[model samples]
Target: MSKNLSALSFRKGVEKNVFERMVDAADKAGTAEKNDIVHQMGQDHLFGDAITLGAVSFYDFLKKENEGKKVFLCNGSACLCAGTQDKLHHTLESHFKKEEIGHICCLGRCHEGGAFQYQGKNYSGQSDAAVADLVKTGKGDSEDRYAVVSHLQPAILTAEFPGIDAYYEPFKKLIANGDRDALGADLKDSGLRGRGGAGFPLHFKWASCRAASGPVKYIVCNADEGDPGAYIDKYLMEKQPHSVLLGMMVAGWYAGAETGILYIRAEYPDSITIVNEAIEDLRSAGLLGNDILGTGFNFMLKTIKGAGAYICGEETALLASIEGQRPEVRTRPPFPTIEGLFRKPTIVNNVETLANIRAILTLGGKGYAKIGTPQSTGPKLVSLDSWFVKPGIYEVAMGTPLQTIIDLAGGFKTKVKALQIGGPLGGIVPMSHVGKLTMDFESFKYGGFMKGHAGIVSIPESMPMIEYIQHLFQFTADESCGKCFPCRLGSTRGKELIAKARTDSGFKIDRELITDLLDTMEQTSLCALGGGVPLPIKNALQHFGEELKGYFAD
Candidate 1:
């Protein structure tokens, strides 16, 4: 009885996996012994499920053996154009296996390409020879890079570090005044929607989490900026780490959370390093940890490095990953604000979203509101691909014309066919419609597009839209978590249909059939990746339908 009991001691009513359950059990029974017990349980069928136990032990062993054992560089569209993947292979081919020498999606360092992540730190701008030399001698130069090309007020992307006081002082003033409620109210008044793809209002998330009843709560900075062309969150984390950390700290105070986490994707090692350093600075300055700012508001900040899963960008999936579970998007009704991160009322804000908090608090909501349009207030960061003459991170007013923003990036170096205003899942707007669009939530939403991470990828007149659509479907299919059928099957089928449409002139893609699949995915999938996969495809069909007439018999 004691032996069996020792093998199973996870908390009741808590959703945890077998490994997590084993880890909790091992707190008393010892790790090695518990592992053995779990393995033996699988053979003995002591637990109700033998297959589950076997699977858990198998994965646990594999996870431990392979942790931090490989390196991957961005194979994303922006990085591919920059030739990062080839350069990575040229550098690390001899040192690592073909499996190890792999490609990743955009590291959000689109402008400063030639990027590769080793262990957990990102290195960029190194030549192939230089990367090889670094592999041999353990010395190389890699750093974060950004540019401010806009004349508008820059709240998030403005890089002038005014010391710790600059970020914390505004919130410190608010805290001292004992107006805890004002923090969220100010955010609401500012109309600062999340800079993440969804563009959900930030204040409402904070207010709900604050109002929720929980003994333990969390404020998570979702720095997992996985969108291919989007690097704003990456830029913010790398260049303005303190601002993001300070924002999380402010969120922590408002949501009544003692613990804050910066969940950064594994691709941006530079971001991870910078954010961790910023947290240490906060701790050293007595800004984090117990009794912050002599105000008795205790807060702790930690950084969790992601395993480069795109689905983990979803808040629920992120929380699941932090809890050592498979990163699958969970159903939401009990949203993250109400029940998240171990069933505690948690608020997850992206790096870009949180970066706005300190500025909002300082500027006052109304002041901040006056920066951009009424619906999409304040400054927004735009990450442009290499096709742009001056491709870099640009901060622009939210409602700025798309043409104006493109002009800021030195216009197109080539004849632009279409533009993906967001990431891959964002709309594919033809050049004809560029004049009609504005770089804001309302405008993009009205145009059946998303202002997703505000990363703009240019589609040259030379690159076929069908090929690009294929790439989108392929990416979605590859990254689908397979937790739901709609996204899982739809993305795969969509990719196959697109591939066929490209190769076989007779292979007519039934538009209605494709629409049904897309609608099913959009209406029923677990998260945005599944639902949002069809947006770009739909947009492509809308603008380029005449061009695609060659593939289908009309």
Candidate 2:
């Protein structure tokens, strides 16, 4: 009976594993309170009930209240900025019971203010007809609403997007040549940094995994893109899935690994379905399974849908989630490349980083390097929020002017005072500083900002700066993994402090107290979740002090 339950827990049409049973069980039962199934999973996996529950309880989607919900509203930064979530919620309530509606962080529909999930499909709630049709007949309208274009002369990421064929040509050529060393060399020459905000060199990680001695190695693509305004990864995975898969296959070949895992967010149901289809297509084309293309190279790719934890976007937490453990941040030095998934050498690259692999190979290292600046090479994909006149994904050279990007997006729809470049952890750039910045790692870093995920969320002139700060703290508090005190406690405390000040006009926020708090979190937090949250907060305090006056005590 236990074996049957365990077997049943594994999702169909994907490789089998023990860790995913808890997610599958919770998904099937619509609640994590299935004690019998939890016990079975614990017993089969050789773990305790507490560990199983911890794993199940880590995701926001598995909450008991969210169970069996037919609608989910987007409270992401884009939606928040547009002030459409409340109206969307009210509209959804008119159609279904209030209990039937839930909330999600982001749905990669930042271009459209009203983003929601209905019956496991993403839809923009911006249109009343679309929502009415969905509520009435289950099937809504289907049209290509978002724009995806490249400003470069020769596009890299979006070149083959909206079309998925012949992406394996570079991989086939690599197999024919059998020069694995050149793969590493080209990546190094291309100077491709991680697009996932850390800006780490891609070749260094690939080389580290290649050099590590392990009988079993793994290549993981971090498709858990939790950044609220960011959907570049989603665009690539949904439209050009072959590009993502081919990149993973290339990494597997170079790093001497046979297995690859793509961890996509549960919010992105379309990405999961499309990637799964693409993997099956690869197998059919004789490009995926053992002894591929008449060569001895063997690679198998599968997808793991995230249970909706933002911290899982972090590589170590992602690894933990895949291992069926609590998705807490693990201490490093034993970096992922050294000791990763299943205690083997693992190469975890961002979705955009992996998507760039095909481009690097096709253009050659030096040729690809010539597109962007000296330090920041290759073109990058940037996502613009709904405030823009034309909000969508645009691929631009790495060092393109920030103003140029805004202009390309058709500028703001209304008067905008500031821009929140990157995600929650990124700096809050006042409109005056827009001309001083460019779209590169060094440029943003030099300007006291982070080019993280390159998703720009506009702050309207009407919204108070204090309110924005409050949102950041609240986001961090809600998403903290609770492993360390600094993040778990600090984020909550920060949110409360901001709340108190906002509610009580006479309440003066002690600058010293907040400064000390930020310093402690920045210095002592276990991971970026705790540490990086201070950046945007500090940027606000520094850049928008006049706007935030009368709230501070010091």
Candidate 3:
């Protein structure tokens, strides 16, 4: 968050909700959509989730009651492309009557790395100095205005973006105070769906866990945002640790979960530190572990780091990883709800999904539901990235038109040949049909994509589309757990076929060989990875037949 412009225009939905006292979104992130993007510009880790949430709670805590305080709330997920940060400072100072404390920078690129201090401690996988800071030590000197908050994460904060303001604050208080009906009703009314890929209805999951016949029910924040190009979970854990803790606490209270576990990647060093600190903070404040906010209901949480496998992102595999086993995926005959971790009835939600719980409890579910389309009723964190016109996190409404996002990104940097919907495993949307697309689950199916992690990849003219597809296939092949036949062998075969098609001096282009390999992987792969792996390659080849002719000419 580094830019020194006079002011910045409202990004899309900001103007509409400006009047609302408590804004769910931060300066950079919009309505909460999980756009899968791995930021290469910033040397951050825990993947990316650590950045988003780290920025959130710090900002929320810094400027909650005192709107008169002009603090620069720079979200970690959004780095300064131009003058965005400076413009934000101007807006906060002029509009909110808050003291314009210096910018709360994240991503360490705050006006040419201005946010970092030589004395700062560099967390292994986190930005050098992304967390909020009020480092100016003084004896209550009123002249020192800038708080210097670091690493305000957008990932956790956006969970409540769907609801209006402190709609969640009240539910959080109620849950802390032991009001189950209010907690349940608010979460339900918030229409807060889980941010996990499964997208299960949050209220339904909570209710199911709450009503389970078992003596004990469990709530799990699937902090393993392991989808390729996703870091929202890590960001939340590191930045807004309490938001996630509070979410789990509220979920534990609502779903009757005696305990909860945050299954995150051990690789995310920043997340571990921040999460541990937040846990300690709440424990000291007596709002975590047990008797939160003086409620009779008791709850506890633990952070289990994952071994870092894509499939582990699947709830079953994640449960296995947390239990200290190999991170292999398990089937869904009895979904996590019935036979989850330790074969107990468990509810697993991604970090962004669970982040909404505290807010939903504070705000009525109805308020939350009003944020997005009827079907998808919550703000989502989309980690937007890659060779796009604009590269930043976008929080668009669930059903927002894809064109709006494309346009929002200032259009493609190069000629837009194909818009790859979803992630590497997701299919390609040829240049022809992208116009009709919308950014929700419903429209994703038409393009033969499932909106996995809301990953939108832009294909420029310079991209060797066929080679890119093959690269994805190769990555999938390498990552395969070797559990199932289709995924294990099929991905291998598919990658081979792509290689053959790309550079095989083979006298003949065995189209059937490639087609059959794709077919087998699609039909037999264990999870979406191996199964979905063949899609981009096959779809690209199918859609760009003319382009493939060059390779087959041998």
Candidate 4:
């Protein structure tokens, strides 16, 4: 392999503007390689990582941002749109404030790249910098767009402060509100599907759990994000953990759950410690467990270590593991709603699913529903990885085009051949189909894409198709629980077939045989891993068939 083949920087993709800016900056500095700069992004911007969902916000110190601007209350739970918009507002406030001008009427444009919203105005691509720059530099903020600065390093400046629990700075003056039920109503109206991969309607889940036939129900947060490229769940757990706690508490109250469990991946030690610490602090403060905020209802929460099996991500397997049994999946007929952990009805929501519940409880569902695509409401947070530019967990209103998602990631780092939509079991979207794609379950599933969990892994043109499939199959085969026949035996057989596909020997390989095996797995496998294990291999064989046709051409 050439030195370039091993180049991580070659995988560097970005928003064109961010790419140009970083490239120009790195060139002038001439101090480091591009990959080094890329890796250091989370540190530089104080974005801890993908799983933290949020990190320390410097907007607290920026003079312009804190001024008369209404605080949207940023946190990991609020995600990019909230964070990016706040930053844009801050930038505008900073720009306008630099001139020492008190012009609140029309503060130029939102320079940091968010659409500005007030009772009377709609400012897109307008920031305080735009207004201030117009006044001071006498020019409009010419920057066409903005992208999340991915090359920034993990920040410790805020963490260094005395005991910060939330990823953002500790805010006091607990803003008071009236009638929290109205807040829940607004969220229900917002049409916000849970940001969790299920895309299950948030309101329906809460209402169903509430109506479940039981005196004691449970609300479990599935934080075991074992996905290869997915790390958004860990982000909220470690950084803005309080948001998760608050969301869970709200979900418990709304769903009438008496107990809650956070099933975290035992592998994520950092997340475990952070979450535990926050829980301990909250307990001591009497903000949890019972009589929360003095609302007559009581709910208790506990954290359990997951066995790290992929199937454990399925709710039934999670409940079994929590019960101290081998982490194997159970059929979802009685479902969690009918027979769950300890045989009680349960509401199993994702970490991201519950993370935004607090906002809905406080803001109301209707207001929340206005954000995204029609079928899929609210902001969807996808963890962008590998081939995309500006890739990270981005929260946007539903129906945001797939191209827009890639654009947000800074476009392609390599020549785009296809995209793997939903992690291991996801669909491979072609370059031509990028524009036709929408970020929703129905649209994705109809296209043979499964939203298994919100993991977006891209495949570039230069990548070795065969090797990628081999690596992915190895993961599926190894992770199989071995309880069921098809998953266990089928995965083993699948791997063997793939190995044979790699070697021509003396005769033509049976393409039909391989396709038939894939079909059987899709139809009869026990779970998602078993079912979708054929995706990577099948896609590779179908698209790169010509390359394999010359297997004996040597």
TM-scores for candidates 1 onward, in order: 0.86, 0.95, 0.67, 0.65
Q: What order do you get sorting by lDDT, best first?
A: 2, 1, 4, 3
Expressed as tens digits, the lDDT of each residue in 1-554 for candidate 2 is: 32232233333213655456666766787766467876877776666677777777778776566577778888888889888888888888889887778889889888888888887888874577668877898888634378887898767788855433466776888987768787889989999999999999999999999999977788999999689999888988988888788889999999999999999999999899989998888887888888888789888998998888999999999887787777888888889898788667899998999888888888899988998899999999999988999989999999999999988888888899888888998888989999999999999999998889999899998888899999999999999999999999999999999999999988989999999999898899999889998999999999889988789996
Task: List model 4 lDDT by residue over 1-554, tens digit each.
Answer: 11121122123311111123332333344322234443454334332233111111111111123234331211111122112445654665554444322212111121122433332222344445454545464445332232223211222111122343332121111212334465456656877675555577776667766777878677888886566545567556765577677667666766677677787764454567778898888778666666555656676777765533566677777665454334467765767777676557777878777666544543456655555566776555566654455655666545777777777677865676766666566666667777877878777767655565565666666555665665566666766766677778777776676576677466444667667777887788777778877765666666666655643232
User: Residues 205-247, candidate 1, lDDT per residue (tens digit)?
Assistant: 8889999997788888888768888888877787778878878
Q: After superposition, how far is residue 110 of candidate 1 from its true place, in Å?
A: 1.4
Candidate achieving higher TM-score, 2 or 3: 2
Model 1, total clashes: 1
Error of 4 at 491 (Å): 1.5
Candidate 2: count the clashes. Answer: 0
In order, what lDDT does every prediction score? 0.74, 0.85, 0.54, 0.55
Q: In candidate 1, which residue ranges exceed 4 Å CA deviation? A: 1-71, 80-97, 112-114, 118-128, 131-138, 153-156
- Top-scoring candidate (lDDT): 2
Give the candidate number with the greatest TM-score: 2
Q: Residues 382-431, candidate 3: write the lDDT tens digits.
A: 55444455544566667777777766666655576876555566667787
